[model samples]
Target chain A: MSHHYIKTENLEYSYYGGAKAIDDISFLITHGEKVALVGANGAGKSTLLMLLNALKFAQKGTIDIGNTFVTEKTAKFIRQKVGFIFQNSDNQLFMPTVSDEIAFGPINMGLPKEEVERRTDMALQRVGCESLKNNITSHLSGGQKRSIAIASVLAMEPEILLMDEPSSNLDPFSRRLLINQIKSFTHTCVIATHDLEMVWELCPRSIAISNGKIVFDGLSKELFYNQELLNECHLEQPYLAKIEQMKEAEKIRSAN
Target chain B: MENLDRVISEIRGIETDAIDRGSRYRINPASRIIVCFLFLLSMLTFSVFNIIDTIPYAIIVILLTLLVNIPLSYIFRKTKYLLLFVFFIAAFNPLLDRRPAININGFIISYGWLSFFTIILRGYISVTAAMILILSSGFIPLCRGMEKLKIPKLLVTQLLFVYRYIIVLLEELAQIINSVKARGYGKNKFPVKLWSVFIAQLLIKTYSRAEMINYSMIARGYDGDIKTFSENKWQRSDTVFCIVSILIIGFLRFFRPFVFINNMF
Candidate 1:
């Protein structure tokens, strides 16, 4: 069976006469592969994810998700196959309550009421947010809101997940909770994030984007040692890696 | 800033309390709608000088408020600004008409005064009834009630989104205002010249936020239709509540029972 679940060839997008947001980007993800997208501010990581979900149409080139080309006609199908979690949980969670947020996607898909409720309950349970089932979305804390946002998209049961900055502004506990949840997902995942710690822990492969172009794509461990490449991409090694280097320097000093 | 915080707290209080199952107002949203509509309709049907007719309606409002465990003082506080508006609109009634309409004891009551009093009564009843509905039914149930009443689904969805986004807009505005304050902007009396520029920026941010919301919705399978889970069940008590309310309102509107009772003494 083919492993290339998503393939974009020479994809290009410009934002409303502004400079190119995405330029000649091409990549492929195997089935069930977890990849991290790292970049500095103003990089095209978010734009690329949006293009994959067909939230914004590319100005040039093709996007094929699960063998279906993304177009206006096929956008709905493409969206069904690719669930997107936005950077700001507030932006994604507009429903009144946690249960409503979870059921929103399933209900919009025209599922039966019972099925929608079942999926909503299941999703809430999966994220350990079942206690917030009836809580108003606005009253929820930052962590609860993020969990509910993920639950909302997960209720759609998409094959591929495109997450934008999934761990930004979360408390340490919630951040660890999110990492654990991401670790448990078996679906094909592409996460765009500034949190190199999350990238190191969750993704085996890494893709670095800079100025709307791919700067590097390879094994996650290999990318950590490439200081020049990391500096070019405006990223740093994971915190744990930095701690290890500090410990290694102390040992060298002690031995000398 | 205290005023803004107070307003936000009031809204949050309403949102949380409206859905309490222990509250008497937590009846079927559809039944609440029917009663609210009938109450408004019956109150509006009274003659211009039928101030006595609203006595029963006022009693109903008081009873409902007490039964629902909502603070009467809170309702009055919230509606005071609206009462000011209603007062202004009816202020001209007494000046516009001077013809004598009735004699109370030795004094003659002018037709304008009678009508002015009636208008004030009407405004009070209508506004209080609307507030009761809102406080009792909450926003989500009210939308569900509208949906069950055969209102256009699009309009219902718009109402829900508007209610949800208004708080977000307010919060976003608060953030901008805080940033401006940190940067040495105006305090109480803002500069009038900057109003247009500030509003324009707000509009742009609102537009972009709306686009992001729409994109998120679409990604989750929104096909121009928003669907929500409504567990509102219509019980037998809802039917009984609807029937009893209609009959009482019908009596008070048509028979003028308070007037008869007043004459009996």
Candidate 2:
């Protein structure tokens, strides 16, 4: 059996004026694998994430999401199978109430009313937001709003979860809570983030993106140790990684 | 504080009945439509014939208004907004007939002020009553009630569609204003020509958006039959609201003959 849940082969795409944004990027993630897409801004990290969810169709190559080939005809099916959490929590939390927002995708899928309610309850409880069932979207704090936003996609029970900058603009406590929530989920998740330290903590496998290309897809330990690679990507080694590097350099000095 | 407290203690619907939170009343939209039309007719009636006897009908109209859960304070406040228009109507009343101030006692009150007051008061009563019926019953239920009351399906459905579409249009309008604000138009009003041009642009966008929405609705299998799944079952509380409403309405309508002078009130 293949370990890959999402497999893309030479996925090429361009925007208006024939400007190539994402060019021939290929990646594979095993089932239940937590992957981090690390990149600076305009590096096509967001674009690739969108392609995986079929939000943006790849014209040149194939994006096989959960074993289904991505196409316009199969757009709805792909969308159902994959949940894409947008970078902006504002865009995701559109519905009036928390429960309704959570159940939006499922309802659009035309699930039975009872089934929708059951799924909503289950998903909300899973995210520890069952107490916020009746509250309106506008009244929620930024963290609570993000949690609810994630819960909305979770309610649909998507096999593959794509979250774009889940930790951005969040307080430390909220970020910790979010990390805890993500850790508990067994779903195959891909988080696009500028938080390199978070990537080190959460993702066992990291993909470094530079100029819309995957520069490195290696073990977490290797990604952390490679300072030159981080420099190339304009990413700094996190505090822990820096400390470890300092200790290693000292060890080399003592040995020499 | 004292006057407001007095007003609070004497709210029209405070003693009526508890509101049915589950919302299960057959609010006949057509009934409200018909009643509002009648209320409008009464405005014409008082204007055409300037008799103080018309005051009774106006008083009855106000009493009917009190039947709904509309607070008396709310009514007083809303009517105050109409006072500017009321001034124009009052101006016309005095000119029609300069009837001399007639009184048995030494109190000489002009018939013009009296007639104008009666006309305006009656107009207020009618308008307020009509508003209560419209607001309390709710636009949706009233439409449904009309449907249940054997209004033609086409008309009922058309009314519902228009009502539902209005929300979308209003949101679109708000969004356009917001975009305009984002581009530095929010803090200040525009020139007349510029405002008109913006409005025209908005109207075009709104029309196209509505058309797109209609297409989306059709794609989503909206075949025009809006089957409501909400449970609007009539309960004991609904019956109580109806009963108390009728009693209060009856009391106010017939209170003229009894003339019970309040001791404390």
Candidate 3:
């Protein structure tokens, strides 16, 4: 009896009197599905993610998270369920201390102090950043900041996570750390990233958007090998996919 | 750019040092806040010329600093700029009044000189008390103390936001300045006109970043109200500290012990 955890119908949005950032897009994510959102620059992946979080309301569409519709009345409730991690860790980690940053969401939800503190500890442990509980946010390195940002989102215990460019500015070690954490999550995750390697490893399903339209929607395994569609959407085949291609060529040569 | 870095580092150093000090640092922030506030108010009640009467309050500040394990040298190092600014402001007092007020050891001292010295002493004592408050309570506790004292919630939260973002803004500015230097724009010197442009760009970037942060906050269930984690509570020690400090301030303001000492002499 699994239903769509997140559903959008003909989503369209514009930015401040400019052209449409998201135009005529529709998608549905089932419970516990990790989907990768792939697109070129200005292809509206981020705008769509914001819509899902209800950070921005669509001018001409509807969004539903779980059974609740995303409207003015339900925005607060929806936000508590959909946690968003922004692209820039600097923007996300605004609190003075790491512990405060993690507790902010729960505190805002009107949770009791003990509950908030408990969630903060749990989130820090889950991210393997327990040692940073007392560290100041500004003093942390880039990797530490990213981990704390993720911990902040995780502390809310959200049912769905919307992450924008999670691995964009991270070092390889940090990226691997993040990929493993995302891999362990059972919640519905929709990640908008340029890191196709992350897509290959962490996401089972892939959705590609171009000109604010979903150009491809299928398994990551199928989408990576579709050279024509990857080129059309201005995405490169992931390194692992290229390795797989080389292995196929070797096998053909040995059989010949 | 280096100067900016120095200022930021200095502020950060002061903040960190304030939090990591000794036994007084472990005192309830509310109690420390109440004591420091009473101390400040009692000093303010002294007549500007009643410099001798303020000695007890100054002693209280010194004792508190010692109790907190914040070194006198650290206070002077952090507050020298403010102290110098105060000195310059009080410099004109000595030139304005010419009436001879006191004859000390056959040396005539003008009222102007008397007021000048009084002003300097007042500035030193008051600024020193403020620095000790910062060192003892730290910024977060001070904000919480203000909240407990029934300051407007909006104002208290705004104070916290401003304090947190001041560092963020300074860090952003430092990065931009460093980037400009890295680009070979100005190595040793920054031109005023170029700095103007850089500042304008910084404003735009800050505005956009603030917008993004606002959205992120909304996405995390912030509903125009900020709720803070209440980590401080009133203890028996806090009550004793507050009541005893208030009584002492009342005694100093009313008794004028220095006046009695002068009459005895």
Query: Which candidate leads the pack in DockQ?
Result: 1
Off by over 4 Å in 2: A2-4, A250-256, B1-265
lDDT of each: 0.84, 0.69, 0.83
- Model 3 Cα lDDT, one tens digit per residue, A91-148: 8876657888899899988888899999999999999999999887778988889889
Every model: Cα RMSD to truth: 2.7, 8.8, 2.6
TM-score for each candidate, following the candidate numbering: 0.93, 0.63, 0.92
Docking model 2 quality class: incorrect
Candidate with best TM-score: 1
Instruction: After superposing candidate 1 on the true structure, give the runs of residues whose Cα lies further than 4 Å from its correct spot.
Output: A2-4, A243-256, B21-26, B185-190, B231-233, B260-265
Q: Write the per-residue lDDT of candidate 2 for residues A136-192, one digit (tens) a residue.
A: 665689999989988888877888889889999999999999999999988899999
Q: Which wins on DockQ, candidate 1 or candidate 3?
A: 1
Candidate 3 lDDT by residue in tens digits, B1-265: 7788887876665546655662333567667767877777777776665667877777777787787777788778877888898889878877887778878898988877777777777777778887877766667667787878887988988987777566667877987877887897556677799989899988887777777888888887776666567446788877887788888888788867777677689
Q: Write the per-residue lDDT of candidate 2 for residues B28-68, one digit (tens) a residue.
A: 34444554555455445544334444555665666655655
